[model samples]
Target: MISAASEVFSHAGKHSQDEIALILQKHLKVDSAGHLSNERRISPTRNQWKYETFSPVWGAPEGLNSKFAPPIDDLKSIRGVRGIPHQSLRSVAQWINSKIIPRCHMEWIVSSGALWIVQLDLEWEETDQGKDPADATMVAEGLRPISTASKIFKAFTPGDRTSWPKLKNLEDFDFGTTRSGPRLYFATAEQLQQALATSGPLLETEIDELTAGRAVLRTDLDRTDSGILNLPRTDTVDGRLAVAWLRDTLPLLSERFGSLSGLAVILHAFLPARAAAWAYFDPGTPIAYVDALWGLPDGLQVLPHDSFQVDIRRGRVISQKIRFKPRFLCEAPDGTWRYTEVLRLKGRSQVLSHEEAIEIGLRTASIAEKLGQDAQIMWFVGIPNAYGVDANLPWYRAREKAQQAPRSARRYRPVPVSKQDDLATLPQGDVMIRLDPEAPLIRDDAFLDEVIRIAQARKLPVELQGSLLSHTYYRLSNGGVPVVLAEPYSKYFRTRGRRVFGKLVRDRVPVGIKAGGEHVSEARLASDDALPGLFAKLVEEGQELLQSSDKDSQVEELSDLLEVVRGLAFQAGAEWEKVNQAADRKRETRGGFQERRVLLETSLPKPQADAQLDPREIKLHEFLRVEETGSFASVPIAALVSKQGYASANFELDGQPLVLTLRLSGSRIELRLEEEPSDETNQGDLFSAA
Candidate 1:
């Protein structure tokens, strides 16, 4: 019996050894002692032991095919095999009756040498007196009205027990057990519809009605008269029975069919022959599906070849094809069959971080910086004008016109132009000049020159002049004219005269014209209304000098007249004439004699005794000596005056000395030589000549 049980265990490909042992112990009564015991008494010790008996003779060739003995009645009734020993055949019979026949198990049917098992479990549900008429109608409709038998039969194949044949009721149905694993109960379409409707509200109510009163029976038991022996039904009496039956029966079937065990349940239905049988079982539930398929009892294994193949493009599964490896299939959260790996692909994920965005911003900033001064202004709709006419032009023109008016009429002068006309007349250009209210009047010559140059380049007319000298006007070739007034000429002449005269006297040079108060007074007298008498006196004096006969006296008077003319020219900012050349020449030609050149004869104040003694000259003298080598010489002196009364230096040297210094002041010198002196005597002779 144990040997037959081992064969059965080996044939049940999916059940673990422990699970098979439990099943055998529960149903076949094959104990660990390798003996078959009846439920009420022990059998006599039967020595049916043979080495070949323990071997799988039902699948082996010689033992069952041997001609030594005819097949025993028990063995024939169990599987119809001719075997060698009666005891051995009886053992096989007990194994078949307890573990194979009643449960519908078979092994090694030999059309060929390949071994295969055909197993089936049948379950019958006894209808109650109050069984819903709706359930009866559902049963009559067929086990799987929506699916073809061939399509539905695959669900009940061995190695899968998580699904089962759904039944509406159990009346006049065979409740026979064979050498199969366990009976499976499945919900009918009506029961499943009710369960689905009760479980989910959003699904259409019609879906609920299609599955009500449907369930599959997973275990075999006698139908007692008492109603307490109730069969499992779908949760909802009206919901779609197919999915609900699958959901409820699959859990129990998977639990009973140990991991990988294979079994099949076939249901009898009133439909046509092609639709009478419905198979139900789960495919092998992966470890992950244990909780979800826990209570299922009739689930058939869905082979890898039976799974649907999906074409994945990009991230989505598009079309399905049969004959691919069975991906773990389970009910999704939405109660639909879904591939677990595909669901994982649909999950949401993030690809960028905040820091990455910040880095992009920094890169943009860097790019903008590299573009440098070439940035262009972006324009938008309806912006106010940035460059407008100078607001101060009206006031400026009014003041200017007022100043131009005669003094008496100026007080009543009106605005030079209306504000609108003033704005309309403003010049337009690419460059805008903003005038500073506190800017000083245009006084710098260079600045004025640039302004004039720019205006000329742009063909804008303008002019330049000192406001105190004279009025100058400029006209553009096109027609615009501007006027500029110089500084007062008289004031410039007086100021220049005072400055030049002061410098000349302070340096002790000869003053050709005086600029003291008396000279100024004389000038004032010449122009003042109160100085007419003085002018007349000066005219009388001039006439007397003109009439004098003594040559010396005449010369003196002529000199005074020459001085007055020079003073006049100097005050007027004109070059002074040493003598009135016109007057002197006239006198010489009229007198028939040449005038003597007095500048050569007159002493020029000894040429300023210390004029050549400049501090820079002394420094030069020291530098030359410091840089001089052997025999190079530097001579220090108090003064060096030129023959023309302009003082500098006279340097004398001999040989190619590095340097020679001629002192012109206590701190000044003049260098003359470049190279070292060969002899001191030669340098001395050069100094003596200087």
Candidate 2:
């Protein structure tokens, strides 16, 4: 039956014997009386119980201690008085006498894997209520050697242990029951005050407020025992003390508790790793030191992926090795320090590292120390190459060179020679010579024809009679060319002749006469004798006339006269080698006259040629032609002067009254001088000798 039970036990894995019994009792039909009666057949004899106790004596190692013996006979002697089987009696004795409870001095192995030995340092406060023996034993095992009950009593009671009275029962003594009573500890008030002197009275008060009057117990917590402390623990006072120490030592961390909480929230939200796998704490130190170590302030939070080293001494943080990179510097602005999966180079080549940043801070401090209040400091981060340093550097000179180079390379090829030659060609048109009728007959077509004749006679290169005479009858005697001639009293002659002729018939004086009568009507004869001399006189007279006119009028007249003189002189003196030279020189200095003449002479083709002159020279020549003739020579002077009071009958000439009439047509004046009957020179032969 026992083998069957063992076999069942083996088959059922970890099932209990009770469970097997229940299964058997439920499945198999057995009377209870019979079951009990059958159990006796399978049982060992009465001596076997004693043999069970003695078996270790023969099979155990030779030197093993035998202190585990049970007091079986004493239990049996007591149990025999109460009726039972002998084997049952022995079983009862073995069970009752077994070493179930440990001795007070023996070491015990804790369920947490730690070995604990009972020490003499068990400390307890005497109370009206007795201490539990189990609690007392646990405390003894946990405490150090010097924390014994007697020493604790002496320390708490303020008396010598030998002098304290011994009581028959602990409950009889009138002792305090509260745990708040004083106890022995290393951190005394005086020592605490001395240690906190530099931190000022506030810190001292804080420390005192946190720890004062509290009973302190010392215990060494070792990691080998899996003894670990967390932020929250069963000992509220100790936990609060730890928290207060952190807060006081690291004020910035306390201030940034919200940031830390936010980081925790982010971690929780993302769950990048196992929940609650890591923790953070204040590394009690100065803010500057923290800033230096972390390359920033305590507020500069980070999302580290693994275990990290926080050295309170150096105020530095070093993270553990991790496959995942630090995704972000949590305190930086959004996106500035964001993580990206794309592989890229990072570190010193990327940005300033924490160490470099701290070194920069130190250098900055040194510089600030030297520069004092005048110093200004600025900080920047990121790859140096990412900035537009090179792009922004001045390129003014380069730009200027670039701009100028293209312009300079644009070659300015000279205008084609053919185009220039084409431009140089004379233009074809009529050359109109505007004549002033009042101008001397020496300036008439007769003179003009003489000039042409001379030019022809000399075979000079010139265009003659090709010129158009304006403001007069068109006449040139040498070739019978149509010349403009002025009527005796036409507005064209009357207006122009008034200045030299005055208001009399004798006013029509000949040219070359200077306010004198001998030179009258015979002016053209001088040219017959000496053409050059006559031309000299004419030029002199023209110059005087030009000078006499109003400045504006004089410029105009002089300009016109220069054109005519240039042409005529060129013709008359064609036989002379210096004629063209003189004409050209005069043309060059004659205001804008010569330029206009050259232009017209070339462009108009003497009313015979075919090509046109250049426009610039044409404009100049037009100005010269208009200037040579005074404006309005064809307008009658009498129309300008009052004629209302003049006689309406026959007019007289040389004091002889004659029948005559006077009339005006447009700009012309008409006068009729009739013969008067006279008894004097007209009477035939009366005074003549027979």
Candidate 3:
């Protein structure tokens, strides 16, 4: 199973700033003025260790060691856990003390039963990557280390994990941004002095633009103010420009918007990543899709790329396709980002592992569910972690259909060509061009046209011999001709060919010569309940052809594959034209198979509705209500709704209420009753009894 650690921290970054603030409020006791409480705490420092541990802090002696508690043995075991063993605490302290620069921050949980380290912050004062694993102490002490403080709280608290993005007010401010104003004003004179010190000579463009506009100075507005500050040119460094702009606009903004003290200044550090993924949920089809690229996801939507489809609710990938990626965007050494040619990746290459894709898909689904609408997110995967940089709803919508959709009538016509070409008027006489399997199979229209010209010069009828697809394209580009195949085709192929090809299959007869011929009409109307089975067989054969090294076998397989398709369409009483139109519509909406996607697995969720309950759920529901009595009889029907393969019911037994959870354990229904007062009633016994 893919760990939710990456998703949790990534979401916490930008999308769930409110949750980040809450985590700080609950654990770090960060107050208004960005002050940490005197309370001892362990804080995560945004540092990572070996892609496994999210953040590992040093000093736990001041935060937790002196106290006694049970040790955490599993990562997930942190749930409902209140403490750690005294030795585990000491080991954490030892690790922190071993560091030369013991810059540490710690916090203690009051609500949790024991001294629980919610967060950890460490300053090792070393650049060596080998010194990163201060967390190895906790592991060495037989205690399970945690990823983030939020992960611990999520497991112990009864609330949904933070998933989506939401904008909030200053009270919940974990991060902030700066907005410009019309005129300059500083809270203090020192700020103005600082701005002036950073100013540089203006550029020609700035001077020209300034000369073209009105010139007003601070001294003009107020005699007490200093003479007009010559702001740096816009062409200068952004910092100088920003400082100059703020110096000019702050006062004007304050005049219009009132007090500016409430305004917060944010200094954000860029978390650079070489690769990114753009993931979204289409609620209409209710599937999750992710498009990944080398650098940032900027402009990824408009680019041809690889993608993966996931079953939203079940968190399983339904299909994945890796196309020929000729170029990838990445950051340059000087800090410029651009697309660069990567010849090695030009061929079909999997950019992300299966585990990474699953995590991304599940996280996308979680976000969409939280938003209660279709949404998308941009994620950056810098080694050891992924970051959620941005998220928003799509700006485009599907094309609207007509109120009264037009009906397409099937019509047959000769392939249109320019009248000036005498070759177009040439008589197509009886001459079959046998395509040798060993020869180069060039499908270029120009090459095929040249071949046709030679045949026309010979004044012989042209009967094509190739795969059905090639023949179909040829007829569509040129004109109709009989497609000749060697005799002794499989019975199934012959029957399908007769229905699909019409008179084109008759001995020496060209296609499109007769409409609704006897063979075609008879084959269509004939009872072929087995057409569906034949289609499945052909599909399986096509897959085998993909694996076979023999090109002839592959060509042969593809040759008759279309015959089964057309036969199935005919069997359904639809014209080939109508089927093609339907296929076009599907391609526009769901996309095409040009990338050659493969369905790796199907982990679809079991049905949960009353009308479509899984058999185990039905049996459990029945057993709880019918086969069992007393507490089970009074259980709420809604409580039996299964989630994550388990359901819990709260009911009173012997005048005391307890929660009995039921989950499928192999072939049996296992029961775990919590808050039971009797020591004799073991959860194992209850499972056995069930």
lDDT of 3: 0.38
* Greater-lDDT candidate between 1 and 2: 1
Tens digits of per-residue lDDT, candidate 3, 185-216, equal 11222333343455323321232232222211
Against the true structure, candidate 1 reaches a TM-score of 0.13
Q: Candidates sorted by lDDT, descending order?
A: 3, 1, 2
Q: Estimate each model's TM-score.
A: 0.13, 0.12, 0.25
TM-score of candidate 2 against the unseen true structure: 0.12
Q: What is the C-alpha lDDT of each candidate?
A: 0.27, 0.26, 0.38
Give lDDT tens digits, candidate 2, residues 1-690. Answer: 689888877877665555544234323221110001101111222122221111111111111111333334432233222211223333332443253221111111112222122121211122113222112111111112222222101232322232111111111112234311122322222223334454444432332332331212222112223222111111112223433443453333224332222110000001010011111121221111111111111111121122222332233433222222212221122211122221111110212244433433343333334333211122222212222121111000000001111001101111111122322332333222222111123223344444345323433222111111111112233233323211111333212112343211112434434444222333333344444544544444454443464787777667655554554555465644476577678767875443434422333236666554454423221223211122222322222222231112434457766643333322234454347643333222321331
State in Å the error of residue 107, model 1.
19
Cα error, residue 440 of model 2, in Å, equals 99
Per-residue lDDT for 57-175 in model 1, tens only?
11111112112333434423333223333344344434444443221212222112221122333211222122221111211242232322231222332334343222212211211
Off by over 4 Å in 1: 1-138, 142-204, 210-690
Show where candidate 3 strays beyond 4 Å. 1-267, 284-286, 299-302, 345-347, 383-690
